[model samples]
Target: MENEVQRPLADFPVNIWEDIFTSFSNSDLGSDKLKEKHITLKETVKESFMASRANPIENIKFIDTLCRLGVSYHFEKDITDKLEKSFDCLDFNQKIRQERCDLYTVGIVFQVFRQFGFKLSADVFNKFKDEDGKFKAHLVADARGMLTLYEAAQWSTPGEDILDEALAFSNAHLEEISSRSSPHLAIRIKNALKHPFHKGISRIETRKFISYYEAEEKCDSTLLEFAKIDFNLLQMLYRHELACVTRWLPEAPNGIPDSMKHLYRTIIDFYDKLEDELEKQGRSGCGFHLKKSLKSTSNGYMQEVNWLKKDYTAKFDEYKENAILSSAYYAIMGVTFVGMGEVAKLDAFEWLSSHPKIRTAAEIICRFTDDITSYDFEHKREHVATGIDCYMKQFCVSKELAVHGLFNIVSNAWKELNQELMRPHSFLFPFLMRILNLSRIIDVVYRYEDAYTHPEFLKEHIVSLLIENIPI
Candidate 1:
C-alpha cells in the first residue's frame, strides 16, 4: 500500500495559555474578615430556612434561590429536608384542582421535585392547557413563567407529550420576548435559549446568575451579597486544589507531552489512590475492575491518535464509533468509580464498559457539538475528519446541510439521554448523575461555540470560579 499524505497542520497552535493559577495568593484566601462574613450570612440564610418551614411556598422559593445561586451544595441537607417536608404536605392534585397554582409556582415545584428524584406526574402542567389542549397562549407574556417552564420541561421522560409540547411552546415565546425585553432580561432569555438551566454547569450558571440577580429590581440584597461572598470563598478553595495538582505535574510518567501530562496524570493518580483505598477496604475485585476501566479510558486517547494518522474521511457511523471514545466520555465514567460502594462501583464499571445508550448519547452530544462549532478551525489543521466532514462526504451534502444534520444528531442524542435518565436502573443515581453532568457541561462549553478550545468565552467562568474574589 502507498503511503498517504500527512494531514496539514492546523492554524491554531498548541494550548499555550499562561498559568493563571500561579498568581493566586493563598494569604488573601479565606481571610478572617471573609470567614466571619460567610458565617454571618450563612446563619442568616439558615435562619430564613427555619422561618419558612411554616410556609411551603416560601421554603420552595428559598430552595430555588440556593440552587440558582449555586450554593445549594452547601445546604444540601437543609434543602432536602425542606423539600421532603413540602412534598409530604402539599398535595399536587388538590393544588391543581383548586386552581391555586400559577405557572411560576407549578414550574418551580415540579422541577424541584423531579430534580430530587421524587417522581411527579407531568400532568401537573396539563391544567395550563386550554380546551383545545394546547398551552394557554396568555402564558406567553410571562417571561419568568416561560423560562421556568422551559427549564422544567427538560426533565421529561419518554411518552410525556405534555413536556415535549411545553419545551417547544416555551422556547418559541421566550425567543420572541428576548428581542424586546430589557437588557438584563434579554441576556437571560438568550442564555436560557442557548443553554437551559437544567443542562447548565452549576458553577457557570451561578457566576452568570449572580450578575443577573443583582440587577433585578426585586433582588434580595442579603442573598445577593451572600452569594458573592460564597462564590469567592469557593474559588479560593479551587485555587488551592489546582495549586496542589500543579505541584505534582513534574512527577508524571514520561512520553506524554508537557502540555497534556498534568491532566492525564491527575486523572490517573486519582484512580490509583482510589484503587488502593478500595483494596484496603477489602473490595479487591471492585478495585481491580476500576483499574481495568481506567486502562480502557486511556485506550481512547490511543484510538484518537491512530485515527488522526490515517487521514481519511470516514462514514458517519464509523466516525461516531471512534468519536465517542475520543471525546473522553469514558474518562468521566472512570473518574466516578472512585469512592463508590463496592457493588455500585463494579456495576457502574460493567455498565460503562457495555457502552450504554446514555453514554453514547452524551458522547454524541459532546463530539457533534464540538465538531459543529470548531469545524472551520479543525479542518484547517492536521486533524481526523469530524462528523461534519463524514456527513458531507457520504451524502454529498453542502457544509450547511452537513452541520444541520449533525445538529439533528445532537438533538436526538439529548432526547436519548433524557429518556435514559428517567428509566429505572440498577446503578446508583449519583453515578448516573456523573454522566448527566458531563452532558450538561458539554452544553455549556460547546453550545453556539467551542468555549473549551477558544477559552475566551470561558474566561469569565474561570475567573469567577477560581481567580477573582467578590467584593465584601
Candidate 2:
C-alpha cells in the first residue's frame, strides 16, 4: 500500500449496483411458472395473428405492437412468413386500390412496411397533402393521426421531402396538441416526441412501452402479460450472467494501472472464447472480422489519447474519422452477428470492413449522440476534443449551434440508414438487425447524458430490468 502511486484521479461515481448481481442467482426465480404462462400467451398471440390474417392492416399493426413491446423476437419466423405472403399481396395504397384507409392506417402501414424493409414509398402519404403540397389542416385535428404520421416520418430515407415536411409539421403539432389531449394519449405522444420508437433500443423502449401499451383502450391483456413475464424471466438470466462475470473478474490478469490491464485482458479473453465457440459452430472466419474490429477500435482509442495528451484539437472531419471507430459499434456489430449462423459469412464481414453506408450511419449516430450528452461532464477532466468541440472550432459556432450541426449529422445518418434498409435485402435481415440494434444502444445509453459513466441516472432502467418484477 505504501508503494501505491498518488495522483489526480477521476471522481467516478460509486458503483450503485455493487454487490447487487453478485448476490443474485437465476435459479430461485419462478421461471418454470413464467415459462408455462409464456407458452400459453405466445400461442394465443400467434393464433390471434393467424386469425387476423383476413385484415393485413390490423395484423401488421399488431406485429409492430409486439415488436415495440420487445417480444417480437419470439415470433420472428411467423411474422416474416406471414408478411412476405400478403404484406406485399395487399399492396393497399389508397391511390391505387381505392381503399378507405385513414391517415392513422396509412401512417402505421407505411412505418411497419418500411421497418421490415418493404421499400414503401413516401408518395403513399400524398393524399394527406393539399394542392400546395402541404399536409391538410384538418389532419392535425386527429391527435392519433398526427402521432402516427410523426412516427412514420421518423422512417424517412434520404431525399424524401414529403416525409421531411411531415416530420416538421407533425413535431410542431404534437408538442402543442399534448396539452389538449387525454392524459393517456398525451403521455404516449410525449414519449414518442422524446424517444421515437423507430430509433429507440428494444429493451429500454420495451420497458417504457409496456406501461403505455397497458394503458391503451384495447390493451390485449394476454399479450401484455406475456411481454411482462418474458421480460422478467430474461432479466433473471441477465443477472445470472453478471453474477458469473463478477465472480470471474477478480481472478483475471492484473498489472500497474491494474484496472486497465485487467479490462484489456478480459476483452481479449472474451474474443478468444467467442472465436473458439464460433469455430466449434463452424463459424471460422468470423473471428478474423472480430479481431480486425478490435484492432481498429484500439487504434481509435489511442488516437483519442494522443490528441488529449497533446492538447490538440482535431478538425471536424479528422475527429469524425476517428470518432466512429472509437464508438466501437463496428466491433459490437461483428460480435452480434457471430452467433447468427450462415447468414454472417466472411464476405459479410468483408462488406462491413469496406465501410458500408449503414455501418457509417450507425457509427455517426453512436459517436455524435454520445458527444452531445457527455461533453460537459467530459470537459471536467482532460479529454480529447469531442465532435461538438471540433465542429465549434471549425464553424465558429456556439455550443448549441455546434450540437445542432452534429445532431443534423446524426439525423441524416438515420435517414441514410433507413434508405439502406429498404426492401431489396442486399444483406440478410439478421445481419442488418445487429447494426440497427447497435445504433439503438447508443440512443438509449447516451440520450441525455453519458449514462454509461453516470449510471446513477439509469437507476430506473436497472430496477426495471433486474430488480422489479412486473406484477401479474
Q: What number of backbone clashes does candidate 2 have, counting pairs of residues 3 or more apart or in separate chains?
A: 0
Model 1, 232-275: lDDT tens per residue?
88888888878767766766665655445666676668767777
Per-residue error for 370 in candidate 1, Å, reads 2.0
Choose the strongest candidate by TM-score: 2
Candidate 2, 66-125: lDDT as tens digits: 888889888888877866765556554443234367888888878877877877778878
TM-score of 2: 0.90
Runs of candidate 1 exceeding 4 Å displacement: 1-8, 13-16, 52-55, 85-90, 97-100, 251-287, 297-312, 336-351, 354-357, 392-398, 419-425
Cα lDDT of all candidates, in order?
Answer: 0.76, 0.83
